[model samples]
Target chain A: MQDLVKKMATELDLKGEVCPYTFVKTKLKLEELESGEELVVTFDHAPAVENVPRSLKNEGHKIMGIEQKGDHLWKVRIRKA
Target chain B: MKLGILLTTSPENENTNTVIAISTAARKAGHEVSIFLMYDGVYNVNKKDFAELVDKGVNIAVCALNVEQRKVGRVEGILFGSQYDHACIAADVDRFISFG
Candidate 1:
C-alpha cells in the first residue's frame, strides 16, 4: 500500500499573483523536479486554477487533482509526464 | 507554449515597448506569440516596429472598432479583429499578459 500513496516532491504557493506570472513561476518550479515527480501548487487567484492547470497539461504534465483549500484558494497537484 | 499579450495603450506608452521586447524574446525562443491590440493600442498597428513584428510571424490582431473610432486608418494587410478575438486568444494561449 506504500506505493499507492503518492508523495509530493515540491510545493509552490502563489498568492496574490496574476496571469502569465503565476504560470511562469509554476512552470519554473516544475522544471526543477525530476521526471515522474509531483508538485502541488497553491493559488489564491481564481483564474490560475483554470489557467495553470490548462497550461501545465499542455506542457505534458498530468493533473492529479484540484481541491479548494479555503475561500477563493485552491490547490492543484501535477505529475510530470 | 503560447504567450498572449493584450496591448491597450498607445504607441508612445512604455507598454508598447515592453510588448515588443517580450514578443521578440519569445519568438526567438521558438515559442508561439499572439498580441491583441485594443483601445489606444490599436495605434501601434501603423508603427514600424509592430509591423516588423507582424512580418516576423508574430500574430498581431487589432480591434476594428477601435481603429474606426480613432480613425487610425488600417489597411487590409494585417488581421483586423475585435475584442472577441482577444478573449479567444487569452483562452487559447498558455500564458497571458495585459499591457495597458
Candidate 2:
C-alpha cells in the first residue's frame, strides 16, 4: 500500500529554475498528467514555490503542500484538477 | 481569461496608477494579469502597488535593458525580462490593454 501510494506521483526536478518559466513548465507538465495525478516538483528558486502553486491553483489545480529540502530549496506537491 | 497590461510610461504619470488599479481588479475577478513594463515604465517596479499585485499572484515583468539603462533597482519578486517576455505576455493573454 505504501509503495502504491508513493508511486502515484511523478517527480519533476526543476532545480535552479525561476518564475514564469517555472510556472510555465509546471503547467505544461500538469497537462501531461491525468486528472487527479500528482506531480512532485523540486524548485531552487524561492519565488517559484509560491508563484507556481498559486498559478496552478488559479488554473484549477490543487496544491498539496510545500516542503523545504535545503536552506533555499523547496518541493511542491500538486494534484491535477 | 488572462489580461496583458503594457505600461510604457513613467511612474510619475497616471499610467502607473491606472495599471495598478486595473491589474488589481482583474486579479480580484479571478483573471490572470501579466504586466510588462517597458521604456520609462521600468520605474514602476519601485512602486508599492506592484509589490501588492505580486503578492496577489499577479505576474509583473520589467524590461531588463531599460532597467540597466535607467539605473532602476531590481525588485526581487518581479520578473526581469526583455522583449521576448513582452511577446510571450502578449501572446498568452486573451485580452491585452496598453497604457502607452
- Find the candidate with the highest TM-score and give its number: 2
**Predicted candidate 2 versus true structure: per-residue lDDT over A1-81, tens digit per residue:** 746755889999998666556777887898899998899999987656755776677678998889998998998989899
Reference-based lDDT, each prediction: 0.81, 0.82
What are the runs in model 2 whose C-alpha is more than 4 Å off? A1-3, B1-4, B8-42, B45-95
Q: How many pairs collide in each candidate, listed in order?
A: 0, 0
Where model 1 places Cα greater than 4 Å from the true spot, the runs are A1-81
**How does residue A59 of candidate 1 score in lDDT?**
72
Residue-level lDDT of model 2, residues B1-100, one tens digit each, is 9999999999889888888888888888999999999889988888787667899989988866677678888788888775557877888999999998
Tens digits of lDDT, candidate 1, B8-86: 9999999988899999999999999999988899999888887789777799877765776788876555667655457
Looking at model 2 chain A, report the run of 10 residues with the lowest lDDT sum: A46-55
DockQ of each: 0.02, 0.04
